[model samples]
Target: MDGRKPTLKSSQKVSLLSSSVRTVIRLRRTTQVLKKGLPSRDSPSKVLQRQQSLGKVKAGNQASFQGSQYFTFDTSAQPPQSIKKKKKRPKNPRVLYPGCSRKYLPTEHKSKAKRCLLLLVGIICFQILNAIENLDDNVMKYELDGLEKTMRREVFGQALAVENVMGLLKDYLATHIHNKPLVISFHGPSGVGKSHIGWLLAKHFRSIIGHEMVLHYFTQHHCPEGVPAMSCQLELSKMVTEMVTQAEVEEKIPLFILDEVESMSPDLLDTLGGFFHTNQTNEFLNAIYVLISNFGAKEVTDVLLQNVTMDLLEAQRTTEHLRTILSPVLSQIHPLWTSAEIVPFVLLEKSHVRSCFYEEMMSEGIYPDPNHIERLVSQLGYYTKGELELAITGCKPVVGKVNLL
Candidate 1:
């Protein structure tokens, strides 16, 4: 036996090589089929099981050279969802006024800015209104002070009389006692500062001066000559009612002044009783009524002359005493006098008349020499007239006599 290895022929070697190549290709085809059966990233596990079953069936007739067609995924089956954006809402515009201290904001926040501006404007308007009301109150106080000062400084020989009236007014304003109207009657001779005092009051109260709320009736001019007393009373009542209605509408207190009240018919004067009664609720109940008369002129003159003769001060004749003395005199004229307060307009003495004369001369820009003043004083005739005439007249003529000088 020979000791040598056996060797295959060339044709057999070629056949063997072809079979090995086919085996390798078959193994690769199996692997690719398994890979194709796996589920895609987006597909469910149930789809993987269905694909595996279909691959097994297809494997029996599978072609080995199918390229990459089995590996390609169908992405169009589920497209990526489009992202949606939310829309924003629009805003309102801001309004601005003069003198505002706010900064401007962007248009996007205009609604917020408008609300803030409105709040600010409301606050500012409130402050302005408060300041205006305070200013009005201060102005009213100033006017009242000026009125009091003018009365005390301008009117002479009636300090106590003026002060009493002022006290009544102050009490009325402070306490708001509205039970009835303040009825004051001036009882004294003419030119004794009764009319002048009334004029001062009218001038000071500008709201009522020359206004319909203030009714001044001079008996000499207002009384109709031929009219019957009843007719006159009816007409007066109608006029007063109309004035009172107007005053109530305007929220003002009515002031009625009857000058030369002694000359008025008793029936005409009595017509005011309806308004003066405490139980009455008419708008005129809140009115102030002033009656100027010479009913107690003789009594006032007698008291003053007695005081002068005794060299006594006029202050000794107090308001209470004068009131007691004049009450009976006033009651003689009208029954309404019982309800009214009697304020005596003092008779000006010779000194006060002389002072008035000097003041008149000064106002006229005529500086009087001492001798001229003496002559002016001499011209005044106090005792020449009878007691009745003297008691009825007052220092008013002194100004005319000064003019004559």
Candidate 2:
């Protein structure tokens, strides 16, 4: 006996190799099915059992390995892979400081002026709206359009004067607050509609603003020749204070008309001047004063008569000149006229007097014949200049003349 191991035949070795390859292929297929989560032909435990038995068979069959060592596959049961959880980010992550270990979030800056500016703008807008409302409430109380229409229709041959008066009234009455009372001094010759305008204003104000709110003071009617000047001054002051106080309580502006002011005593003039003073109460300041006078009648007439051809521009210039001339003269009389708005009344032509007669006749319910009106106008005295005859007594005598007709 030589004690040597016997070698297998080539055919037997080939068969053994084929059987091992088939067993390895089956095991690999089973592993792939399990990874894909598909149901395998055998359970995991059964598969493990089968693999163990095959390994045991290969170990027992030592002739298959001959004498060489070969690598063995571990088929032990492995725990199923556990699912890994992802880390979550925090809401406010902190960063380390540049020079320190402390961490903090960046601070945000805001402005308070923006909010304050918005509030300021809102306040300003509110004030403007309030002012506009006040202006509307104050101005709408008077029907200025109606007053203008009345003046245009009733007043004759004083277009410039009427327009100036209306303009002043509009400007003064636009607001209730005034630093000083409005003093309008009407200067012209007698019978040239100065007193007539005063009368019309009084009547209109009485109709619209209540009778108690309007005061018509005539120099002769209120303070006659027998009345003492001091007594007249006291009485005038008392009446004005009462009217103004009542008007203030009612939140209204009163109308004060003084006719024949040229004949008023200096004391009475001074008393009236106190009402138009700047350093007065709000009640006294918020009033309309119309002074009817023949202060510059001769000068006004001479200026109008000299012009001969008075257009709109020429009339405006003449009025300005008259104001300049009359201001000093009136101021010399009393300081009351210093701040007054002097409106010069021009002479009424013969045609204007004829129109006045026609209106008077129609108003009196008498038939207005052209020839009758001409004769009535001719009966009135006139001042002739450059073929232009102006009525000396405007519509003053028209009522009396019409009554006789």
Top lDDT hit: 2
Candidate 1 colliding pairs: none
| lDDT of each candidate versus the true structure | 0.71, 0.86
Indicate which candidate wins on TM-score. Answer: 2
By TM-score, how accurate is candidate 1? 0.59
Q: Estimate each model's TM-score.
A: 0.59, 0.68
lDDT digits (tens) for residues 11-115 of candidate 2: 999999999998898788888876996666776798789779989998877555554467453448787799999889897997556885666568978789989
lDDT digits (tens) for residues 1-405 of candidate 1: 597778899999999999999878866765775689643343467557867988987875454333456665564589878989887756785566568576665766457888999999999999999877765554454255567788887787777778777766654443223787788888887788888778877656545334776777787787857768887778778988997778667655667788878777767777866667888665767677887887888788777655443223546455567789989877886778988978887666556666777778888878877777767766665633323122234568767876765
Task: Give me the runs in candidate 2 sitting further than 4 Å from their true place.
Answer: 1-133
Where is model 1 poorest over a 10-residue stretch in terms of lDDT? 383-392
lDDT of 1 at 223: 82
Clashing pairs in 2: none
lDDT of 1: 0.71
